[model samples]
Target: MKEYIVTKHAIQRAVERLGQTEQHAPHHLKQLMQTAFYQGETPGPNGFIRKFYDHFKTKTRLVVIGEKIITVYKFPEAVPIPFADEVAQVIKRKFAKSERDFKRKERALSIEIAEFNVELAQHRLSYAKAKSPKVRESLSDKISELETKVGRIQFELDEAIKAFNAIKEGAAKYL
Candidate 1:
């Protein structure tokens, strides 16, 4: 078992804060050590002071001087933030809508790319069977243009999908 050497100043402070007497101070200090949740640390005159919150949300600051508890006191007027959960819900909804929009754009781009591929294939068949050089050249140019369009659309679709994935990852942290 770990033993804590409680300081005299710490006892007086705890007694004054809890409206208790000197005799009750040791029990109060024991309870504070047992039930407190670690809040954080603060800079003290000597060094760093460790802070904790008890069951009633009372902030207790204790400084460790060697093996002893140096100073213990309640930090003044700490309050929990309001509407944190509600703000999180609002952010989740906004990110969901953003994900949906990106997915929709990706679907539209994919459909356009599929159509361009089909058109390019048909133009290639026409270019192969054309009797005149002029008709074959025209069909070849059309096929090239369609191919470029398909490539651009496919690139845009990939970008949109990447955006959706990024949004999903970001929203997971909050929601």
Candidate 2:
């Protein structure tokens, strides 16, 4: 996220230019920058003139010194959202959330796989030691069922990884 400081002079000018009171100007300016759609920039000596459109659709130009806002001027025209970084934050946040969910699922699946392995081993031991054919057959059936479940879980884990990787890659491209 872009960081900036609001100066006293900037606050005064914003009040004057925006026709706002002293109490409202600083608060309003901060809100505008937070949700502002960045328009364009003009480079200058210490910083640049960063343009933006507030939530109210008011066109605003900020004179920035270093990371501080030095002054503000309001224009009559409306500015549209054009910054990729703005959309990038939303996309990145969505993917990050998805990634967390996928990772959680992957962990759960891994634990299930381990549990299945233990069950399969127990069934294998029972089958080997069983004197009766029926007992051996029952153990065999259970082992097969557990194997199928394990396979399904593995497939799902693979798909989740693929999705997480795809999102990561796609987000990186925009960044």
Candidate 2 regions with alpha-carbon error over 4 angstroms: 1-81
User: Alpha-carbon error at 138 in model 2, in Å?
Assistant: 0.8
Candidate lDDT values, in order: 0.74, 0.80
Count clashing residue pairs in model 2: 0
Per-model TM-score on C-alpha atoms: 0.54, 0.52
Residues 80-109, model 1: lDDT tens digits: 559878978988889878977887887788
Q: In candidate 1, where is summed lDDT lowest over 10 consecutive residues? A: 48-57
Residue 171 displacement in candidate 2 (angstroms): 1.1
Q: Model 1, 161: alpha-carbon shift in Å?
A: 1.5
How much is 83 displaced in model 2, in angstroms? Answer: 2.4
Tens digits of per-residue lDDT, candidate 2, 61-156, equal 665556777788876555655986689898878888988898899999999999999999999999999999999899999999999999998999
Model 1 whole-model lDDT (C-alpha atoms)? 0.74
* Winning model by TM-score: 1
